[model samples]
Target: MEKSVSKKAEQTLKKARVKYPIGVKLVVIITVLLLVSLGTITFLVSAMVSSDVRITAEDNNFTVNRRSATEAENKLNTVRSNVFLLLDMLNAAGSSAALSRQASAFFFERNQDIAAVVIPGSLELVNTRFFVSNEIETTLITLFLQNEAAAVRRAVAGEPLLINAAPVFGVPVIAMLYPWQESGYEQAVVTFFSSEDLTESFGSGANSSFMVNDQGDVLVHADYNLVRAGANMANTPIVQAMQESGDRNLQLLYTDQEGNRFFSAFRKISIGDAAVITSIEYNIVFEGIAATTRRNIFLTAAVLFAAILFIWFFSKTISSPVRVLAAAAGQIEQGNFEINLKAKTQDELGLLTDSFVNMSRGLAERERLKDTFGRFINKDIAEKAMKGELTLGGETKHVTIFFSDIRSFTAISEKLEPHEIVGFLNDYMTRMVRCVNDTNGVVDKFIGDAVMAVWGAPISAGSPMADALNCVRSALMMRAALLEFNEGRGGEKKPIIKIGCGINTGDVVAGQIGSSERMEYTVIGDAVNLASRTEALNKPLGTDILITENTYNLIKDYLIVEEMPSVTVKGKEKPVRMFAVVNIPDANDIPGAGAKGPRTLAEVRNLLGIKAPDMNKVDTDAEEQKYKIQES
Candidate 1:
């Protein structure tokens, strides 16, 4: 299933590719790449800017909240000083009236914001005149009496105690104890100040300031409802950041339960184990950064648009010439070698265009010459010649020469018109040449009614035995090919054809052997002459294929042949043994497959339609061990 989907996608892409011209495709590809690169850069820059803006805002908020907390601490210290002074007066006078007057002066006149002044352990409040509500006065008096030991411990330790026990029935205030121990009396001078004093220390804006006790309960809040409800914020992000930050101050960005983002700072108030928290909504805090980012995105988009436009035009300049060259190449592939392209500029693309034109012209000329050369020589040889390997020279090398001629060609031509004779000859020669060419034999030339080929001069079959066997195989296939050709002719009007092939393996001087202006690559040696003679002798021997004794020796183990009468033709002083090949039997089908012994050649004569010769007169014993044939 995956493979099918992938293949379908590939096909769709291929179709889409075909719909666009090279220039358009190039422009699209270049533009897309540029856009991706610029987009990535912009995104990274925006992210970095946003991060820096957040960090800077957090630091400023931390500073602001810290200052406010310090101010609140200073106010609490001032209240402590006033209470200490009142305690000194009470210890000096040791009278209830003096204590009452001192408390009244301190709470009502000296510091009107002081909510209450209490003398703990005396079970009497020194003064509650400043208490706006009776419940506040009663709550403070009760709390001080119950926690007298804690206040005394603070006095002994020289540290003031701050309690946010309750702001006296919803009236927020900070209470502090000044322990008094004068030899016999042990009491704490408790002072209460309104919580609004601390909350008002932080100036108002989009931000809200609040105070939370050690238990995370709201002690004083700009939002009064929170103070009334005593909301716990220990699990809030601001409190979590405060706990995690080992320092007394922390600033961080957090999101609330409603998913509104905020930037908050927390500072431990100097008066007690309370923290002052300032929180501002994220949108308000990062308004300027958001505006800047918007402008940056607009600028980035404009730059990217300009870049893509430039890339598109630039790519067109490059791909335009390439498109023309590609079209010219397509024409060339279809054999239309006439290309007319002009260079438009003096750049690499222009140079490439010029080079392509020259190359195409050169190829067209080469192809013309190649076709003409192929008509005179083999196609493979023509190719090698064009590559400069077919130089004017000669070299002596061992080769297997093959010669095949139609028997009774004159009689056959007399039976048809000149055109029919030409057609018939062409058809015959075409088939014969194919056999030779397929077996790696180079067809050297064609006589009036025969073809001469060789296997080891221009190129070799890599070994002498291979060349000889290839020559024999080509001969056998040519005979089989004739039967196929006759079968294709509808049988009635087709002229029956018979060809005789002769093969010989020997050394020959092979190379170009004519004037420089008109040279022909041909062989001139006794072997070439002998192979022709052997072909002629095929008529007298009544055989379709005959090989000299030397060729026979090389292919004896692979072919089944019968010895023929040894003959001495022109230019040879001794008779050369020849053989008529009958068939190539599968070695596994032959009896005594691995045995090495001399076998009489007559054993295969019946299969080849040749009469057995008298064995005693033929020197059959001399044909054993390894066969050798002289020039004939």
Candidate 2:
């Protein structure tokens, strides 16, 4: 039952461990910490990189936009200055068609950006449309210029307009008119310059450039389709913001109508109310940083996996030994001192395992010593001997000596095989020896089918009287034990057996007695011889337990006895008294026997199936050798 409960507790401990293994906890704890630390570091790095890259990208966009704007403005400025030079030369050569033709040719030569030049008729200048191409080019330019006749009127009305887009010409064009003051007549020259040159300077990429007028109308853009479609960007957030902003150039991040975010930089030029603008999608601007963040995530995951694997193996190295030690502890708890364990490492766990092994060995040795000596000596005496506290030489002790022999043992042995004889002795002696040991008697030796034991030798029950009482109690106990041993034993190999116990109390020499190589603990003197002789007399006397007067005197009050006829010792003239023990009165003799113990000699004789002895017909020579019985 104790083993079962221990097994249940171990199972409970196993169930509790299902979720809380040291290896798993180590992996989880370390993984979480790695995740937190790596995640925070990745976030911080990405944030910092994004911030720096965004600023750098914005600055780059602004720088490129401003340069493009300046290039376009300078081109337009050259056209304005060359047109003014032509007007001055024509004014100097008044009324000369040759000079007028020469001036127009000179202006067109200095600026090939000019597709056509228009001179409105006035007091000093002719309404001349100078075309530089064949009929096809002339017709195409003429057709596109006619659409801007309204802008000419606006220039004549002193508004002085610059229309930066004229995709009507099938290419990028800039048409501008400055108020002309010539000979006090209201007239103007409209020069058509190719802004296509600016398109060559632009690049199409994630970052793109385009020009827009004050009205936010796109012109000279890298995408010629927007110019062709006349796409108006007037409501564009960045363009509107640029228009409102007092700065000449600025960078901003804004979302378009499609919810697409953009990084945009705008620069206003000095000509034609035009501005150069560049923009890139926000995701494209930070794609590199996004890639870096993903790599950081993957790296952190890899490190976590590696660390978990390492911790698992490492924790197993530690916890496995602990598990083995726990199992060893259970084995020890069950009284199995022999253990199989080894220290596989040189760390603290290995040290603990080594210590456990030593402790188990010590216990096994102690148990072996108890087994070797305890059958022939008291356990306390064996312990004292192991600790070097027992005296090796003889000492006189007032002790009770007990001897019991099986009756008709030679006849019983002849009826059984040799193995059966051993088994029979072992079975019978086991019960009888328990009776002796239970009452603090040490078995001194076994002589064939007999047993010798001593009380109050080497160790005592405080006094001779105490030891004597214990010896007598053991004799009664053996009677009951032998009765148990004989039940259902009628077979040849397992014949019914009876034993007689003789107990005597006297001063005897007791100690370890033998040669240096072979030692035995025993008692000697007249008491032991008398006890042996008294045991042999049991068959003739019809008794199972007999005690000398010396033993009977110390335990008279505790036992019921019948005084037997005197027996004269072999060498003594006087006779020694003997008694037949029937019961121990209140000794708790057997289960359901009376509280006063078995009270009558008749009851004992009946229990043991002992027939009455006829001393008149009993004259044994073996008994005569030991004593002379004087029958009453």
Candidate 3:
């Protein structure tokens, strides 16, 4: 009997050893899956966050750039308008063959604005005089005639002109002149522009502003030091391209003498026989944007990192029960069915694990079922459903959809290697999403560098237009942030990230859209399409933020509106009227008038030249000829 008992005990021990191996294998599988899932989730979250940061920086940079360009254009336009007005006065006064010298004298004496009037006949300045009776006129005449004959000829042949000539005492003289042809007198209206006007028109900052002639000669620059040093900006890419292409709105990014990268936008201003090239550095215009972006990014990153740490700790605490269950299962598999899993907490996982212990009578079968359930349904999903996100159907709601696609993402991708491209996209997308999220917009998906988002759905306050406006404002803010990021990158590879945002307010089918196997909470409707098309239209319209007519109609009262021409969208019969959100007017300003000034010289010339002169003859031809010959 003792011998039989010994043999049974030995057999039981052998069976226990086999069961222990199986239990150990199951535990290892669970542990590995947990680590991998955690690692993958962490990596994905980190990658997503990092991408968001980069995109936010890029978008911010682009928006700020756009704003800076607009502001510069507006300011220059204002100055140009003033110049045009002066030209008109000159043109009107100069058109009289009888009053040519009298008009010059009137321009010099009556108007404190006009500094001097230099009338050039063919190639040489026949009459050069200033408002002040000073020695500067002799030096200015000499400088104007020196190597400027070709320019004068071009100006005489119906080309308006502006020339920058350095005079004595290092004063830069900007010559604004146009061809003047009447019955008796055939000449050009040459007006010497005051340096003070140039400085006031183009504000002083790190970024310098200049006006160049069609020949690429620096006609008028804010930087007197550079002008005095004989810097020939005419040969620069900015001037060369303008002369070559005659593109009125020319933009170029180049490194300066100090190796600092600068973005310049050039506009060709033709007075009559001369072209004025206006160029301003982008850096000075968007300096505030750069500072704002840096501050926001640093703050956001700090908060996000802290939140991630909190999430990791919270996840560990929540997952502690699963870890315990895994250990218990390993023990039970070693033929230790006598073990008690006393974690009788009300949580579904704990209850399930407790049930598993009680069903140890058929442990292998129970284990098989548990394994199958774990594989078919992710443990997290199962637990979450039990706690509730698996409710069937979501409510219909009004949502504002925003879609943004980079203008030349495909070209950018082609330029970069596959890995670099991926990195770039990742960085760009991440920041864009973050900006949306920061502004209470939910990111729905990413199609390469494009981002789709929605407001007033999932989580909203019923103000779809307001939400959309917030999103756009945030996007603009993000552009300023990116400049600092680029600065850190040695200012190379300045990312030209342009975004178009369209916001439409309408009801949509909002719910989890997918099979039970895979699902995403999203919205779908015509409004989505409208929003997408609005964003796409940004490039064509030369705008950064664009909103649908519906959206504009809703927010017109609160937000300033600039009615854009109707545009034909992809699936629409009639074109849509989009409105751009202008910067909020100052408290002390009128809605349409922040700053007002005189019309430009070009405009003045256009107004005067619109009606050709019916000149009456004067006997001053002989006197003028005598004066011209004497001056020559």
Candidate 4:
């Protein structure tokens, strides 16, 4: 016995080994490692290439800065020439007595105007004028002091003057006189140029450019700092470098005291002898290059890091199937059936994957049994039966009962084969069952090609009228569907099928009512019998669907009907009034189609024109009571 047990254990081990070979395990490991290695190498190479590009961009930015500085200086020189020409006009007039007087009158003719004059040492106003009553008045000007020197002075004997000053109040004033008498007025005109205006014409090209005097004071910056105080380029690196080497063209990477780095280039502008240093920041030249490079580097690094991490994480997950399976089994044991395992290998890990397979098969088998039982019985009934609630004893409850049958099933069946007849019966029963279900009706069973359906028991149809109308509508819709069905099967040759639906809404006993060994669910009462009788009456009346007066009155609001004269229905002593349901009208019609018999109850009475004793004359409650009394 001990030897047999040992042999069995060895045999089981051998079978498992055969299913999951050693070679397959090696292959999985090698493949996973190779993928990880390739991913890591690719990430590192991309990062290195991006870093090199960043370095190249930094160098290019330095070169661009130098070129922009030179351009700014040239623009300033052009502006200087224009200003000088305006000043020369004043000087030429000062050289001639006639021209000078004409110049003074020109200023005096305008109100509050000062005659601008260029003398040997200064630019002055000879005659200041003022305005009064829309007339130029040289006498009314109280503040006309003439012969004032301008604020600007030439840096060298031959250098032109540069100045910008506005008049005070309405009095025009000019100062900053350059000595142009020795070189004629034409030479004096060349002295008046603006460095500030010159810098503005750079056309969105550079950030800013400024000139600094040798005294380390700001002579003129760009338009950005014209009104600002304490603006100068003297203390800037461009000036310091120029003073040190006297190199007009110089490049240096200078970081401001505020930590803003700049690639600066310096060039000296010489007017005769004095020099003005020009400086420009590199970012002003390159604009968005460095910032874009830095952004790209950061973005590339972030993407590479995320990619590597993802690859490593995915590789580790793929390598550990046993761990995943163990986790899944734990969840399944705890009743969490949503766990899924992805098989990545055909090795032992994949071969040992039968727990989920077995669990799924067991669950599927249980579900199939539950659904199959639910079809035979009501879903609630099947559930209750499964829980052992369906006992043999009967329980009675109030229900509305209905019964229906194909009007001529025997004649219809004779024309078709046995299989075809079965198909027809199934098709007819299915439509009837669907109708019953739609009205919250429960189908008890099929008695041959007939159906017994009930409402207001397992679930209530809300009102008796609604229950009756539901059965009527179902019969109408079934008849419509049967026409289509017959058309498909060669209508006339297939024996056109018709249905008779009878509905009676009243109180009845409904529950499981059969022997203990074989139980059945059904309703039993006088109302049930009346409903069956009404269905039989359909044949005699030549109607497809019929309902008792009690059923019609309950759902009179939702059914179109034609009345049949009072007729004696077997069990009842008094004659019963019946209606043949035609169609239910749409809500948008002139009159709702469901308005029984006609648009109004009067129309129904008029159309039937019956002279028999009115239904209201007989007490239905009394007749029902009499039937109960006789049954007891």
TM-score of each: 0.45, 0.46, 0.32, 0.42
Q: Sorted on TM-score, highest at the top, how do the candidates line up?
A: 2, 1, 4, 3
Predictions in order: lDDT? 0.72, 0.77, 0.56, 0.55
* Model 2, total clashes: 1
Per-candidate clash tally: 0, 1, 32, 11
Which portions of model 1 miss their true places by more than 4 Å? 1-313, 339-355, 384-388, 414-420, 487-495, 552-558, 563-577, 584-632
For all predictions, the C-alpha RMSD in Å is 15.2, 23.8, 44.0, 14.8
Model 2 — which ten-residue stretch has the worst lDDT?
A: 123-132
In candidate 2 the C-alpha lDDT for residue 203 amounts to 54
Candidate 3 residue-wise lDDT, 310-342, digit = tens: 556755634787787777777777855555666
lDDT of 4 by residue, 1-632 (tens): 99999999999776556455646655675576556555555565555564455345445544444444455445444434433443455567666867756755654454222233334344443343223332444332223222113222342244444332212222211122343544533223222222333344332344344444454444444443432343445566656776776666665667777777665555555542123333345455444555555665666666557656766675564457767777877776775665566556555655556546557556656657778987887766676677787776554655557777876678777778898888777876776677667657778778898888777666666766666656666665555555555565545337656666777767777667788788876778888888887776565455666777887777777666778656565578877787877667642232223433245434432333322344344433444432211111
- lDDT score of residue 154 within candidate 4: 47
Per-residue C-alpha lDDT of model 1 across residues 563-618, encoded as one tens digit per residue: 77787666677788889876555433222221331144444333233454334443
Which candidate ranks first by TM-score, i.e. highest? Answer: 2
Model 2 lDDT per residue over 1-632, tens place: 99999999998655444333445666677777677757766675756666789888888787777777788788778878877887788879888989888887777666766766665554222212323341225555455447777777767777655665455655666667756766686666777767677877865556788888777877778877888677789899999988899998888899999999998988887765678888888999889888777777777777767776877787787889999999999999998999999978655676678789989999988888787877655687788788877655888889999988888889989988888788878888888888888988888888888889999977788988899988887877777677677777787777788888888888898877887676677899988888888887788889888999999888898778898888886655678898998876577745324365657777778878899888887774644467678867
lDDT of 4: 0.55
Best by lDDT: 2
Ranking by lDDT: 2, 1, 3, 4
Q: Tell me the lDDT of model 1 at 202.
A: 62
